[model samples]
Target chain A: MDKVLRDKKAICVFVLPAFLFFFAMVIIPIFMSGYYSLLDWNGMSKGIFVGLRNYIDLFTSYNNEFAKSLGNSLILAGLSVFIQLPISLTLALILARGIKGEKFYRTVYFIPVIISTVVIGQLWSKVYHYEYGIVNMFLRNFGLENLVRDWLGDKGTALICVFIVIVWQYIGYHMLLMYSSAKSIPEDLYEAAKIDGASELTTAFKITIPLMKPILNVCVTYAIVGSLKTFDLIWVLTGGGPLKSTEVPSTLMYNTIFFKNQFGYGSAMALFIVIECLVLTVVVQKIFKSESYL
Target chain B: MKRISKKLLCLFAALSLTLSIGGCKTTDGTDGGTTSPDGGSKDKPTLKIWHITASDAEGNRTILLNAIKEAEEKFNVKIEETGTENEQYKTKIKSAMAGNSGPDIFFTWAAGFSQPFVDGGKVLNLDPYIGAVKDKLLTGITDNFTYDGKVYGVPYQMQVGPLFCNTELFEKYNVKIPETYEELLTAVKVFKENGVTPLICGAKDVWPAMWYYDVLALRTAGSQLCNDALAGKASFESQEFIDAAKKLVELTEAGAFGPNTMSVSWDNANVDFAQGKGAMLFNGNWVTGNVNAESSAVKGKIVARKFPLIEGGKGTATEYFGGAGDGYMINSATKDPKLAADVLFFLCEKLAFDMYEQNTGLPGWNVSVDESKINPLTKEISDMTKDSTGWTLWWDVFLEGAAADTHKNLVVQLMAGEITPEKFGQEMQKLNAK
Candidate 1:
């Protein structure tokens, strides 16, 4: 097998079809988007090459809402990193310790990850509904009717509500990754730590966590990229509305392209998303690069 | 044997992958349906139709389906139909038409939505095909589909955003149906005090909220100024436009749509209104169907009327707030214009009749619908429309592309009371300048 792999002709034959498929499906469309971003097109009408005007408008246009959407996505990323990952880490640590019902908890937590995002989005939309949602209902039952408000409708609460749902829906996914990473630690290490009278917390902080750096890096990158690309849940719930307080870049691109028919401007926004995700992924990988060697 | 099995498995994987990838090509939607092999169909060509309603949506889709079934047999051609969800359909149809791959007969939204297609020469001029049906259509219903005195499409549905009031809610709250501006304020005040939402609009969709503002702008500035301002010939910063914005904001401030308008969808608002949760709904005549639907809670308790004339405003109650905006046009690239036009015209007449009978909308065609058999709300609304001196199309439909979306967004903001009335005018003026 290794000798065959060393044959360049065999390698080319094996990889050519998949590479051609990727080039056609992924790379060509991206380049087409780039080319289209330079033209002022309305899908059906003739396009004039406007050259960087669309890109300039994507940032500066008042109604475009691209910058604000980016900020919303960044805020979601921050919350995912600060809140979601910590909770995932804690749960993974506890479960990896071989506690009773560990398998049950692991499987149950991961069920949300396996479920469709649309279902989760709808489930949370109901959970946050002002009239019949569990959140408001719980508040009402506790004699806090004054605090009840439309969670997904109010601009003040909408972004946080969406963030909570998105951050929540993926906790099990990141936890599963971290849990498997934690579980892979040699049993001898734990035994040695136990003989050394090291507390579980100390071992977790010093050895387990340090050893899990590579997986942590993967989780952080996934969280940030996922946050940027979080479209379906937000689209399903608020549609970037209640004054567009919950607008994300993806939703803004969708609205601009589909509703406004500003195909060129929307292409610029799409290209920006690709660049944004790519840059953030690089930054995240760089941040974790040194420690990934652990 | 094991080596042979391994080679066979590898071959199958490659074959399947290639097949799947090749299958990704979009079908023009003409190939899939089971053709009648035993019938005399060797000479029968296929005519493809596209519509906005999803296959699962009951009301309009069913009517369209029935019409297609009838048209197929009558026209003696196989019909290929594709249904797309509304907003997605806009993008799909636009791109498909531009690429010259669109269905022969596709549903086209009237006015500014079809303007690009008409200008791009993608749509066939239907005047030749529609001449026989032209005189049968109600006067002024074909105005939106007529560009430069040539009809590019034909309309089958009509609506004027009428104010639907629930008599049951009004009686329960002891609030009279407001017939004038001052009485409207009083009813709003009373309804709020009695814990009933006075005016209900689903701001979630943004278009419904825009209807509220359109009617207000019409009442404040009259159709002439509204037309001029909307056309950018007159400034939206005019006092009348500001006052219109002020009136819209005033209604929201008075708790007209209630606090959750932005959260509820138009369909949900209809459901809620039917369930007696709101006292009034300013919506299209389509709401009549919802009110008369089998599960409606306000079946017999509903009545629709012209929006009350605002005091000292230029708009008259005779100037209604809707026109023929939904329509269908044939692709210019169709191989057989005569066949497509036949199917289109037949489906349209059937559609108009069904829509009127089902209370889905007012008919654009001059169908003799039985008044007593239709929803009483429809009769009352249509009877009230007999007084209409003029009709103003939905502002969103009248405005082109981004301006259309901007107008709706601005109206939503106005309805939300987030922008001052003056600010709304200024922002609107910005769009007008564009």
Candidate 2:
């Protein structure tokens, strides 16, 4: 049995099925997308090979708005890293201290992660509704009527409002990752810090955070990648509308491919998203690796 | 190492077995229904139908279902039907048809929306089937669905865009129903002075905003120029198109719509108008059904009329921005084209009468209706459209491919003051050129 386990043929046999599945599902489709990106085909007909014209149009055409969509995705990613993760980390630190009803609080924080994104999107859309929405209603109730504006309608506020909801919906997911990693930290370290007269905040920064570096890196990568690919919630909430203020790559791809019948152009947008995600993910890993070495 | 390898092998075996069984179960479930093996007796062919009229209470869902039931009995065939929401139905049908796996019959909008399917040779030319019901349909109604002198779809309903007014609100505010574009502006001023929203149009969906642009363009440039521009023969930057855009901007500046027009959804805009929160709504005739629904606040008080004529515009007061749009077409790749056509013909004829009686829409087919049973708003629309000099299809439906998207997005931006009328026209022409 040991001999069989050590054999390269056995390793190949074990890995082949999973590799084949991955190749079929992931690799082939990407190559197909790349091939389709060079054609000027509606999804229905035989494609005319345009030779990177779709890619050229995606960047140079004034009407495409691909750059604007990429910028929106990057903003979402930046917000997730800077705004969403800190809030998650704070909650995880507080909960890891074994405060009262810790388990209950943890469950409550994790609830949104389990709920369907469509349900969350609908829930947020109502909350941002112009007239009767809770946000406006609360503003009016406080005699701040002038402060009331269309949260999801105004071009200035639509993207921000959507980002807030997205940050809120996934806050629990990141919190859970941090919490479990914090739990695995030895209690003796806390005792050692406490004996040295270190405060809770200091211990959290100096010990818990440093100890949770690996999990934090994982959470950061997840947050950034997830942010770059956000579709379902945004699709339901604004449909990338109110003058396309909330337009992102995924929604743009969907509209161009399905509604406009520019499958080749949409494929170019899809390929750009994939490359953007891949490059950014590697950059994030390199940053984390350098930080760990430091 | 041996123990670990054993455990991994067991897990792998379990996973493969589970996946294979799951696959088998799905295939078995689907095959269980139609595997009768009596060769002598002919098995009933299942006619698969897809439609967008899935709304339970009103729309054409009930009418279509009833027609399907009748056809199933009359033709002695099994009818399988799937109804999806309007927006989702487009993507579903297009992808399915593209994959050559679409239903035998499916609902579609006429003209530019269906042109791709026709061009791709994915739609059956219905000339052979229309001989029986050609006289039954309204004259020129089939023109929207015709391409290259061949009718590819059968029209069931005629939708005309109308400006729906809450008569109670008009009376309360003592504002007259507008007769011309200037009068409409005066009404807007009066309503705004009274602290009422003159018109409640939800621009969030973008298409709702297009209704305003469509009528303004129709009245300013007339149907000929609009169609020419859509066909790329005329430029969107023409003086007439720019004037139409300017008029729309003027209306927007005068606060014709609700303050949060861009935020409210299409359904909510109708609800606001129905609840007397707004004085009027400019939308498709489908709003009549929503307004006349039993629970609507302004049920008996709503009135429908064509868009008021623009002063000194080329279009007449009778011109409208709509036509016979929604209809059903047979998939070219269907195994039984004749059978699908038969089902489509039967369903459309029955639907026409059902739709008229239910006040869901104006029937495209020439069907007699008991006038008393029809909703007053629907009747008002029918009467108003009797002498319409011309009808222009919705711009989004009239313009194909990327041009349609550009038109819709530009209209939204124009409404939001993000682009001037001149810039809007230029952008439209640039997109059209592509």
Candidate 3:
């Protein structure tokens, strides 16, 4: 059986299909996008060969809303990792231990994860509404009407409101990941800690967190990458409106190709997103490696 | 180890199987619903149409469908009707055309938006059909449908942007719906003093905010200037356009637009206007259906009037703001081009006017225009048609390609009061010059 498995033909047969699939689905589209990125194509027109103008304009043009959108994407990524993870980690630590109705609490927390982003976006849009929103209504009922403002429309507050929605929708997902990671640490480590007369906090800080570093790295990497491609919620909620204060790279690419009819520029913007997301992933990996070693 | 490898192999195979089958299933489903005319001698020929009509619009899809049904019976063919939302529909149409899989007949606006399609040879010239139905359409309504001296599509509707006012609110405040710029400002001030919002225009969507600027721009530059600018003959930074921008800025700073106009969305602004929260809304006649839809205090009190004239401006009060509403164009890629054109003419000529009239849409086609056939708002608009000295296209519709997007973003900034009017004009000029 081992001799048969070692056969070259068998190896080729096993790998060929996936290689073909990867080439067709991933490699081809990337190359096509690269090809399309050089032309002044209006999506339907005979594309004019504009060369690097699209990319040059993307980076240098002051009013390229696409660039602003990319900046928003980076901001979203920063908020997700720097802000969301710490809160999710703390919540996971509390929930991971033997607690009342652990299954029920887990189910309740994970429910939001199952809800589609479209539904969440629509629900939150209604909630963030200026005049008739439940949030404003609640504020009025509590006589805190002065505090109520157009949450999604104001340029100062739009991005922050979107960030809050992202955090609310995803904290449970991150918490679940972290909790399972914490649960996987050897029970014997805790028993050994108790024998050493170590306090629970000390045991947790030294043992559990250290052991969960690999999984935490994975979670943070996901958060960063996921934030870079954040589109649906933002599109459905604000549509990068009220002076496009909440524009992000993905939405920018979408609007460029879809609304503005600038496929070439949009493709150039897309390539920038890919490169930025890659750079972010590498930077995060290096930080995680250093943290784990220490 | 052997068992684990076998399980992994099975999992990979199952995943591939599911994906391949899923892809096949989707294609099959799509084909079953939208089989094209080239399905062979044994198959029934099918024609597809893309539209953006709402389902609730009275007699809209039904009228089009009935027309298609009649055409199918006459031509012995099958027809499929699909409707999508505004922006999505345009995106889908563009992508489909790019991929050479566009529907046989698709809806398109009749301006710069259609230029690329016409230039690309993606849309069929409809001059033949236009000539056939020349007597049936309103005079010169077909002119906007012409590109490069060739008619590309039949115009379905002519929308005139008018000031829709709450008559009851005007009566309550003892202020007339202003006919001149100064009177308009005074009326706004009166409304404000009486604790009523004057004009409820939202800049959130950008287009609604543009209406105020369009009227002001028309008043400042007049039709010749606008026509030249739109034709790419004049600079966007001309004194007229700049002065118009400044006037709009002045209006904003003077509280002409009520509190939080920047925050109020298109829907909310319209709803507020319909509810009498504001005295007037400067919008196209297309809004009559929506205004009538609202179960608010000012339901029947809404009345349409021409835009007020500006002080010391060339534009007459009779000059209007509007364009040919979205029209139907045949995809050049369709195999049965004649059938596609037939379907388009059937929809636009036989069905569109009737459906539009019922839904309170102001069709450009020469339909029976008895006052009894239209809503009060539409009748008022129709009456003003004789008074119209000229028409200015919406700024968003005139700026082509990236310049259009740039121009719109500037408008958004202007609406937000982030950029001064001069800055807005300068930025727009830079974009237009590019």
Candidate 4:
């Protein structure tokens, strides 16, 4: 086995396909985007390479909606990791233990994960409807009409409303992952704690929570990366409007490339997105490493 | 076993990487040579036409399908309709053109919207083809299709913006059709006092709110100023333009629009007006078809009139807000340019007039269609265009880049009372600055 491990030729044969694939897909696109980022192309015209102008404009130009969108994406990712993880982890714990109709509840929670983001966005938009929606109707009936303003229309509430929708849709997915990880911890650990005269809460705190740390690190990384790439739900819900207040990086990149025909600039924004995602994933993974969790 | 698992992981990663690279490959090739030449299929001479219409989807796809059917029967060629949502359709057409594999004929707007493609020489010059049947289309609309001494597109319909009024609510408030800006204000005041919201506005989409602002600009500063602004000879921050913005803010402060105007969707606003919840809506001829489909309350009660002129402004009542909607263009790369032109002629000349007869469209083509067949409201909009001093195009239709989105959103902010008129003008000036 040690001789086989030291065999470099075998390693080359095994790794060459993946190396080629990585270069073809991720590495080549990055270089291509960097090249295109210098051009004065509008996705239609013959491109003219002007050298680093798109990047210059993206960073320094006023009314840089792309930069604003990047900021919004970071805010969304931050919120997803901070708020969504803890709540999902708690729900996952409660449901992981012996409970009535656990299978039924699991299915119900998993249903949102199965549904398409477009349908979820559209459904939530109806519920957030200012005038005739069920939420507003109920609010008015209870004389809490002052609190029933346009949730998706107001700049103050638009991003938060979208975040709430994202949480509602993905909480089940995270919960299932955590629940499975929590379940793998031996039940005898809890029995041992009980034999020590520990309460149920104490047993859970000492045994189940500590055991699910590695998987929770993965969950946090997934949540951060996934939230940064959010596009469809935000696009369908707002198209980043009432005044482009709720625009995230993906939608802004989409509008830049597709709507405005600024393909070169859009490519720069996309490259930034890739870099941001990579940097954020590393930071998150490092911050919540398995060693720290242990 | 461990070696096999590692190999499987590499295989999966390789597959994903290949897909990622392949996905962006088509975008890199711009020579329009992606589609392999058909050695055998050339006998059939299939003309691929792209349109943003599907009946099952939203938009006027049903009308486009019937038109396509007529074209197919007349030309003996199979026509495929690739219908998509509005935003998706724009992106698809833009990418298709970029890839050089665009459809033979596609939907386009008349002005600056088509300028990039026209300037790029991606679109075919349809001047001679259109010149053959010059007398068959309406004068202003035919002229609109021409850009820089060459005609590249044909208008399918002429849409004129008019004040769509609720006759029942107007009668309830004892309001007559206002002739001047002052008279309109008086009418609005009367409606407000009578507990009727003067307008059912949906500003969230930004385009609908643009109708109000653009029309106001035309009345306040005249078409000359608008043209100058579009040409970059004049600024949107001028006193006259600022005055127009100020007037719109005044309308909002006076409560001329319904409660929660910012939150209402265009569909909901239309429904509210149809149900007599508001006194009026400022929209184009196309809305007549939408309002007609609503429930009984607004079945026959809606009527349209020319937007009232500002009392002391430069624009006359004859000046209207309008555009040549969805100009049809032929691809220069089409195998059979003549055949593609024939299909467009069919849409512009023959099918268009009949489309009007079916209450499906307002024909921009001059083909003899009796206005008597159209609904009275639509007829008024069609007739007003003939005598109009000038038609104010939508801002997005005229401006390019972030300027279009920025200006439209600024108007929305103005209407929502988020920004003052002066700020609107200044913001636009800032956008227009080098």
Candidate 5:
């Protein structure tokens, strides 16, 4: 085994395919986008080299609306961490305690994660639709007509409405992550805690939670990054509108690059997204490390 | 032994990655071009065509499918047809062309939508074979498809803006028919007070909202001025353009449209209109056929009318909106450009007559189909276009991508009351300044 580990041929064979795949999908695209960011291309005609103009315009341009979009993404990230993660953690805790119909509940909760994003988006859109939607139908049936407004169409509520769907779709995924981690702690630890007269709450707080730290950190990082990179659900739900209420960086980048044909400007946005995601990811990891003793 | 198993697993994972990628490549490479030199599949040479008729099965979709079937039988070719939904098809074709992997013949809208492909040198110059169907086309109808003195696409259908109304409700509610801005305002007031949705504008599909603003702008600024503004020969900051925005805002404020116009897609709006939820829908002439569709509750009862004349406006009832149609363009990289061009023009000619017979659209080509047998609503639509003073293309189609989206966004913002009419005009003027 030591001989095989030391062998250059084995190392190359093991690493080359992964390195190539990563290079092809990620590294090369980033470099190319970085290059494109410096140009004034319309994704069609000849691209003029315009140093830093797209990047400058991205921050400053009113139509680009980058700051607002970034703020929305940050809000989504905050919600994912504070709201989604807690609900998921609570569910994970309950499920990990081994309730009746535990397997059925787990499978049902995980169903949305496997379904296509488009399908989920469309389904949620109908649920939040102005008329004939079940929510409004219920509101009308209860004589709460005044409370029934176009949920996905109004600026004040569009982002929150979209966030609810995202929360619903991802709860099971994060729950499973924490659940498995909690479940993996040996049964002997619980027995030991019980012998020491530790209640379920005490065991959860002092034993299980501390034991689940690494996975919790992993879950938090995934949640933050995933929220930051979210585009499809919002795109399918709103296409970033009514009044640009649900606009996020990824959706804006897509519209700019594909719809507007402003490849260079959009690439500038693409590069910014990669950098933003990376910086946030790093920042999150650092925070988790610093909180290790918590 | 544990370490050795882990190492083996790693090796197997790498092997699988390589195998999967290689497998994908093998499949892609084997699925090669339209015509093969070795002639294994020459008995039924496959041609690729991308269309935007995935949802509308009753109309032009059938024409396209039948044309494909007929072409298959006649030419002994298997056509690989891809149908995408409307908004998505724009991205699909544009990205495919940008990546230089576009279909052999792809459906494309006229003017600004096709400009990128034409500018990218992705579309085959159809000048060589256009003469075959030259006489069949209406005079200068091909102008929209022409770029730099070369024809790149061919149109089969055309539409003009017309105000379609559920007049039965208007009569039931004792509302006066609107022929002027004042009357329209009164009608809106009556309808809104009576709990009926005065207008159904699908602002979620933002381009549909632009139809109202475009026609309003066309009325205020006139077709020539609208054309000039679009051509960047004039500015949008003019009062006429501002008035168009103001008038649209006025309608929204008057509660003319449903409260949730921003949430409804065009298809949704169409459904609402058919269900008699809306009193009026100021849309393209194509709605004439839709109004007569089997599922429509307002069938034959709805009537097409002229948009109300705006006071102090330059546009007359004769000045129209929408005189363009989606067409097919051949990809420059097509394996058989000649064959692709032949199929394109043949389909174009066949679709022209087929669309007319089905009342799908006002055909750009003079139809051989019996005129008297066409739908009455389509006849009203056809009659409306007969005395056209000038027709302005839909602003979203007239403006190239970014400008088009910006235009639609500005209109939506104005509709949502987030932006003032002055601001909308100023922003539009900024697009021209760019």
Candidate 6:
């Protein structure tokens, strides 16, 4: 049995099918998008090769709005790392410690992760509705009428409101990932730390956190990449509107391709996103690895 | 045991490979069957029709479904229909047509919206079919669907922008119906003083807000200038365009719209107007049906009127911002283009009468109206449009592709107070330059 398991032919046979599926689904479409990015096509006609002109226009033209969208994505990614992840990590740490109703709390925290994003978006949009939204109604009932503002209407607050909804929807997902990893740590380590007079916080920081570095790296990567590609929630809630104040790259690409019929330009935007995600993922891995070595 | 397991693994791999190959072959066979000329087993050809009316859109959906049923009976062809929401329908039709497998007949907006399809040779030119049905269609209604003097679609209905006033609110505030721009401003001031929102605009959708800009542009700049600007002959930076923008800005500064206008959706805005929370709504005549619906709070309390004339402008109130924009077109790649065209014409003719009877819209086809059936507000709008000296299509419909998007986004920004009139003009000109 061991000899059969170690056979290279078996390994090749098993891997080939998956590799073929991946090639057809992912690799081919990416190359096709890259090829289309250099052309001026409207998805219905013969494409004219323009050679990086679409890329140049995306960065240089004032009307393109691609740069603004990229900036918005970066802001979302930064917020996810600095704000969302920490909240998720803190909850995970608390839940990991044996507490009352730990199972109930874990289930409650993970509920948002399983809910459809579109349903979440619709729910949040109602919560942010101007006239009868619960958020404003609550404020008004508390005699804080002065604090009431159009949550999704005003450009000043639209992006922030959308960001809060996004953070709320996914904090559960990251928390579950961290909690399971925290649960896997040996109990003897904590027992020894307790015998040495180390506090709960100290043991958590010195032992549990170091052991969870690999999973932490994975969660950070997911958070950042997920932020860069967010569309459905933003599309449903704001549609990159209130004067395009919440325009992100994915929605911009969709509008360019579908609404404006600028397939070539949209393809360029898409390729840019693919490259940006790839580069950021690599940089994140390097940073984590360097820290581990230190 | 090892040998048996190895054999099973090889068998599984070979079985999966054969199954995948078989699946691909079957898909190709089905594709050919559908596209082949004589693939249908039945004698009648199947005709697919696509449209953009939500099932709950009340009268509009009923009219479309009834027409489809009538056409199937009259044309002796099996008819299949699919309906999608408006924005989704646009993308769905375009993508399907791009893939060369779109419906035989589809609904689309006229002019710039249909131009790309015509230019791509995906739309069948309906000029040959028009000769037989020209007498039934309204005069000049077909012009919007014509490119290079070739008609490519059938106009189904006419839509014109009208100011719908809540008469109860007007009486409550003791403000008369405005007849001129200055009087409208006075009315706005009076309404504001009484703590009432003068205009209930759904700027969140962006298109609803564009209606104000469209009317103002039509009145201030006149139809000729607006047409020239849209056609790239005149600059959007022209003085007339700036003046129109300034007029809209002036209305905004006077607290004309609700404070939360930018957040309110079109449905919510309609509700607010119906509930007597707003004094006026500037939208298409189609809103009359909604206001006159069984559940509407503003039934019998609304009055329709032309937008007030801009003081000292070259244009008059008779110049309207609307026309026969929505209609049906036949696909050029259909198995029987002539049959599709026949079905389209018959369906459109039937649809026009149904739309008028249902009070869904103004009929693009000239038909004897049962005047007693229509709501008084719609009757007033129809009478007003009969005297219209000129008409201009909506700016978003008249401009194609990126320019149309720019116009919509810029108008939203203009309403949001994020950009000045000059910036709006400059940005519009930039779109033309592109």
Residue A292 in candidate 1 has what lDDT? 42
Per-residue lDDT value at A183 in model 4 = 84
After TM-score superposition, the amount by which residue A110's alpha carbon in candidate 5 deviates from its true location, in angstroms, is: 3.3
Error of 6 at A218 (Å): 1.3
In model 3, state the lDDT of residue B433: 65
| Total backbone collisions for each predicted model | 0, 0, 1, 2, 0, 0
Stretches of candidate 6 exceeding 4 Å from the true structure: A1-18, A138-147, B1-41
Deviation in Å, model 2, residue A231 alpha carbon: 1.3
In what order do the candidates fall by DockQ, top score first?
A: 6, 1, 5, 2, 3, 4
Off by over 4 Å in 1: A1-3, A292-294, B1-40, B55-57
State the iRMSD of every prediction, in order shown. 3.0, 3.6, 4.3, 4.4, 2.8, 2.2
TM-score of each: 0.94, 0.93, 0.90, 0.89, 0.92, 0.94
Ten-residue segment with the worst summed lDDT in candidate 5 chain B? B31-40
Candidate that beats the other on TM-score, 2 or 3, i.e. the better one: 2
lDDT tens readout by residue for model 2, B316-413: 87788889887999888677778779889889989989999988888898999899998888888999899977878998887786778788889989
Of the true interface contacts, what fraction does each candidate have?
A: 0.58, 0.55, 0.49, 0.42, 0.62, 0.44
Q: Per-residue lDDT for B14-120 in model 4, tens only? A: 56665666666555564352222343345445566676564574335666777778888788777766766666788878888877778788887767677778877
User: What lDDT, from 0 to 1, does candidate 5 have?
Assistant: 0.86
Q: lDDT by residue for model 5 over B1-434, one digit each (tens)? A: 98779778878887988889878866665453333334337556667888888866557788888988887777777787889987788788877777666788889999998898888788899888888779888777887888888899888888787888898899999987788989999999999999899988888879889999998998899999999999899999999999999999999999998788888888889888988998999998877766888888999788888899998999999988877657888888788788888888777778878888878878888767898888888888888778887888888887898999899998998988889999998999988998
lDDT tens digits by residue: candidate 3, B1-434: 98669756755775676578568746754553234446535467877878877475544667666777788787777777788877678787778777767778888887777777888888888766556678877777766768889988776778888888889989987998899888888898898888787888877677788888878889988987887877768776878888888878777777777756655668778778777788888987867876777476676888888788888788887788886756888877676777667666666766646755676677777776455757776777778877777887776776666666777777767767899887877887686566
Residue-by-residue lDDT tens digits, candidate 6, B1-434 = 87988768785976698579668856764552133434355787888888988776566887788888888888888887888988889898888877677778889998877777887898888877779899898888987888999999888899998999999989987888998889899999999888899988988888899999888888888987888888889998988788889988999989898678877778878888888789999998888977888778989999998898887676787888899888998888788878888899898888888888777788999888789997678778999999887888898888887778879888888877889999999988987897
Clashing pairs in 6: none
For candidate 4, write residues A1-294 as lDDT tens digits: 454456675466456666766887789989988887888788777899888888788878747777788788878887887888887888888988869988898889989999998899878888988767788899999999788888878888888888888877888999999989988888888888888999878867778877888888888888888888889888878878767889888888887787677888888888877888889889867776646434
Docking class of 3: acceptable
Q: Order of candidates by TM-score, top first?
A: 6, 1, 2, 5, 3, 4
DockQ metric for all predictions: 0.53, 0.49, 0.40, 0.37, 0.50, 0.54
Flag the better candidate by DockQ, 1 or 3.
1
Model 3: CA > 4 A from native: A1-8, A11-19, A64-66, A133-148, B1-35, B38-44, B54-59, B193-195, B294-297
